[model samples]
Target: MINEPSAPTATHEFDLTTAPIESFTALQEARQEVFSSERAHDAFQRTIRGLQPTGPEGLRRGLGAWMIGDYEGACDALSAYASDDVASFTHANALMTLKRYVEAQPIFKRLAEKYPGEPKAQGGYAEACFEAALSEHGEHEIDAICEVYERELAAAGEGFADSAEGQYLAGRAAEVRRDWQLALDHFGKARELNPAMRRNLFHLGLRAERCGLDLEALVAYQQLASLAPVDLPAMMNLGMLLEDLGRDQEAAACYDVIARSRPMDRRARLYLSDAVAGMDMYYDEDQERKEDRLNQILRIPITDFELSVRARNCLNKMNIMTLGDLVKQTETELLSFKNFGETSLNEIKEILGSKSLRLGMGRQEAVLSIESTQQRYVSGENAEAMNRPILDLELSIRARRTVEYLGCLTFGDVIQHSEEELLGMPNFGVTSLTELKEKLTIFGLELKPRQ
Candidate 1:
């Protein structure tokens, strides 16, 4: 045994002068194993332990750590030996993973300049700078960063251009510019390239929703929810989409799960209550019949009423088409018009009385509604300004449809109803409800609270 131990084998020695090529080859092998090995972290640790601490070998170890998602270890190893271009690039990447974008930008920029042919360097520099610009930078800085990102992306060549991550970055850039269609297209391409990219999926959902592609948004959110079941934002967004599509029970289940999971969360609790109320407020057969009859009554022409020629002519000249419109006018308003006297008023009252209605029956209610709406906007000196038209709010089509459906021609008509009443509309959902609330909030108003 002592004789056998006389000569130590080359493998048994910790040689500091190991060839750089051998270390590079070993690192390549380890990198492949990381993508396929079950014990990838252990493999990386073993490979890193055998490398020298201050050369290409150290850079390999750092890259291995990064490959295995050990960002802290990658930073420590790379920072110690980041003199060359490759080491510096890896160090900047580790910094990005650590969310140190401010510190990572300059290094990435330097590396990109040093190795203009490296796609990773160019892309990393663009991403780092873009992130830095987003975190409270001025518009000029954002514009400059965007220009740099676009230039680097173009220089990265066709291979990187067609890559999944490349498309994701493009989508983010388009999103910042408010180009919804372009963002959606790029995000879709990224997802097709890598179906497991949940970040891209989330962004795709947002873009789809913004573009009014409800089915696409629903599918994207569903896929993201499956990928990340406990993600609160995804869950909430999914619930909102479901509610918008009239799937109240499903939406309620979603809110209930979140509320139960986080009992102390006020937003979750409020959403749960809203979902339950929405479910309970579904239209019944009786309500449907009542709405149909009401609509029919509103469409009745004034010509159907039996009246003298003079009264009929006066009503025609006044543009009073329906019984509904006539009931909305006061006797004083009608008499103030030329050739509209007490005789014509008596005739109009007889016709309305036959239908169990009265002139100006809605006046008092209208006054109260307007006063209530004005009160909501009177924080200081904005009372008179609040009497503006609902059109001035510039709401989305969906929200505008909801308001028009409720006959809300003015801001006064809008504030007369509570949240429950608005949600009770057959076609109105959580999306329209939220949109209307946000528009009202801009004018220092909100939906009337539930009593």
Candidate 2:
């Protein structure tokens, strides 16, 4: 006969169907413990190697090692499954973490275009942009490159609305464009979508406030104060807005709260002092204005105007509780009061001149009059002669094109507008208004007729 092939004997084999899922769960728990334990990073290195060619199993193994700073293991595992978008994105990130920019570039570029609006794609593109900008170029050129990436990423906005990284990139891009409105919109939208996104809300509020969107900015700062832990900026911004809104009591409350929590807050203290000083100055200016008006009308030899009750109340807060206290300071010092503007400053100067007793008299005054003179105005020239809507302002060529698309032409048309109304315009967001506000503030102008 012939030697027949003997039947293969069965080795000890665990039936996968019969095995409890708990066994795998237990393994994962064990792996996590080991991963977090000191000196146990290398414990899984051999296990990862054994898991190769097992689909995502091998990727997981590679990721664990990579997370622990094992570049070789990460590359080995990640390279084995290079076509997987998630795997490729993760691997690209690992390379970036390792400062392997040159190696990470192509991988990210490939994934970004492939997955356009995905978080991973957006993040990868942003990183690539950063890498490109940092590579041996002038700062301005780098800024331009970064801006291009920002616009592209923002336009590719699915996951970006809620991503801190996305918001940050978008904001930076807007800043590069010098488009404050776009920056504000991106930052604000990010905060609205994800309240915990760090620092974006604060920046948005500050920039908005600087552009004269005080109400909108106040809301931003308040949200920031509530959402952010120990955010000094938010508190400071809140206090500033309260002061601006003429809510002295509320401002004092905000200041006290900040001071109690952080006694070393210098800006808070300065603001409080300024508020106190402002109140007193207002009263004094009113009294002076009154005296001047009375003297002018009666043809009496009066040196100054009398303060109104409202003005007196303001002065009391500033420590200018009386006329003597008022005369001791120059017109510029009085004009520093929050509500006291250029018009008030002129009134003070005229009164002092008439009295022949200038503030600080003979000595050079510490309070130099910074009162800017107004151009002579023909009566009725300030307001628009044509009661036509604000849509006729003749905005820049680009702005006009946009407005025409939106079917707008006059100021009255814009007055009743809300954010939703304006955003409906193609390519228009809060950014356009941000620019408009800046232009208006420059001319001592306001939107909505100062209501």
How does residue 53 of candidate 1 score in lDDT? 65
Kindly list the per-residue Cα lDDT of model 2 for residues 234-256, writing each as its tens digit.
77778778788665534654565
Top-lDDT candidate index? 1
Given candidate 1, what's the lDDT at residue 156? 74
Worst 10 residues of 2 by lDDT: 366-375
Report the C-alpha displacement of residue 207, candidate 1, in angstroms.
1.4
lDDT for model 2 comes to 0.54
Candidate-wise lDDT, in order: 0.66, 0.54
lDDT of 1 by residue, 229-281 (tens): 24467778888887887655457656765787678978877876777677644
* Superposed model 1: Cα runs more than 4 Å off: 1-100, 103-125, 138-142, 260-263, 280-451
Off-target runs (Cα >4 Å) in candidate 2 are 1-142, 151-168, 276-451
Q: How close is candidate 1 to the true structure, as a TM-score?
A: 0.40
